[model samples]
Target: MANQTEVLRLLMANAPEYCSGDRLADELNISRTAIWKMVQGLQTAGYSIESRHGRGYRYVENNQLSVAGIQNGLDITPAVQLIVLPSVDSTNAYLKRMATRTPLTEPVVVVADSQTAGYGRSGRTFYSPGETGIYLSIGLPVTTDQPLDAGLLTTSTAVVVAQTLRQLFDVPVELKWVNDVLVNHHKVVGIMSEGITNLETGQISTVVVGIGINLTTAAFPSPLQSKAGAVLAHPTKVTRNQVIRQLLRTFFERYPSYRSGDFMPLYRQLSMVINQRVSLKSGARTYDGVVLDIAQTGALVVQLTDGRVQEFSSGEITKVNLLTGQYHG
Candidate 1:
């Protein structure tokens, strides 16, 4: 009998059209009864596989995440590696452990369907649940002795994600200060970047950037019910596999020149905090200010209430009057 992933691949290749039972059996070198059993199994696994007595099977395309499916759609190089897991503690943690054992000169992309212990900046647990999200992490190894800018890595990845979502879904995607992607005025994606230091060399070798997106997630915990949102609320856009493919393709295509500040123009255009009334909380103090601009160096330029203009490369955004969203008060 044909496996689930292969069945999905062939069905997706002939999406919206029925592939005859004889054809499926012939390609997989199985019997018609085997194909029928496989189709039934797929239908039970939350996939929409429609079949008729005379006609064959049609895929409605709300697919579960599979490495085979994702890799089949990627336009990536031979050096890039891809991995997909059903459940993991965290994609970033998994890659960090792998980086210690594996030689990583090229790119390695690891994605989990859900994370039981996912985390973002400041060590906050990202609410990752199954059947509705994509948690991805990429390992970028240091090819040369050049140092990497942690800030640019995060900000640049944020711009790449926002750009990909806009191009694919045609939605009003925006970026919050630092590392958050907003959709429909709510946070739909959370990004975190970490530099992995080699224990032997005492130098940072690999940079792990994790991206978590709420894709068709309809419910969240009570505390996050209002703050979390989904990229595609309905099955209107493309599949999750396609989303991952596009994000990977776009990010790598610009990786060579991202640090050159060429992405700043698009970053500035997608910013949600620029020129907005904002409140910055640095340590125990909270100061109110209005954002001026996103500097080329990735620093946040703010004009505070005391009339002292300041530029902050790092701070806590306790509150901000987002034009797309209402104030906390």
Candidate 2:
């Protein structure tokens, strides 16, 4: 009998047209009963299978979180299961609930078509339009011989996401220090990583990494009309599925090294803020300095004109002229 993947492939190949049960069964050389079971399974797995009494079954159009599309694009076998949700409050929150029941690994990916409550760094609300963007979260379980600081992981994710966007979309993507992806001087993506360690055991159990990318949309909220944007806000339109696939492949390719605590090399090579001048803003205090480099421990190293170098962890900083598309001080 043809499995779910094969059945889905047939439906996708014959989209806008219905595939009869008998035809599907004959193609896969299986009984109609097996085909019926597969259809049921697909529906339960979040694939919108539309059935007509005489027209047979057809794939629904605009199913944003298509498991079949994502499965076909993945090159590496997933270590953790990929759960595709049609609509959710947030992928991070959903996966956190699953982590309590299931032991999630590095490759586990959770994707949603839309989020009801998505936010950027510092609790700024993220505008996620249904079927208009990529909203994903990953769970990374860790236990280090030495304690791993939280800020390092956030910076690493920020840099990787910025590079991934640039390479995939062929755009001038920039990193806003902690966890924002800017394209053409506007915010297009946001990443957040939260570490969870057992208090009594002191063992780092899991790090929930959330990534939100704006794609396909053409405009931002009314208030953000002057500052934020989607990829379509640039010169081209990128599919949400493509963004998710590229990000997953890039992450998996680099994750092994990160797991071994050797990600500094990749971090150094992908650093976008180094050698650029940025403004650190916190309340009334603001410091403008030239970025020297990012330390192995994930500190932003900066050198003032007076020759004083300082390292900032996270928060308390923002790239000067980030929205201007200029890296100059």
Q: Give a tens-digit lDDT track for model 2, residues 89-114.
A: 88887877777566555546899888
Best by TM-score: 1
Error of 2 at 249 (Å): 1.2
**Against the true structure, whose lDDT is highest?**
1
Mark the 10 consecutive residues where model 1 has the least summed lDDT.
320-329
Candidate 1 stretches greater than 4 Å from native: 1-11, 14-60, 232-237, 282-287, 322-329
- What lDDT is obtained when candidate 1 is compared to the true structure? 0.84
Please give, for residues 190-306, the per-residue lDDT of candidate 1 as tens digits.
998888888878888999999999978888888887788898878655778888989998888888777777888889999888989888877677889899998997888899998
lDDT of each: 0.84, 0.72
Q: Model 2 off-target regions past 4 Å?
A: 1-6, 10-23, 27-63, 101-106, 145-149, 234-238, 259-272, 281-286, 305-307, 322-329
Residue 236 of candidate 2: its Cα lDDT?
A: 45
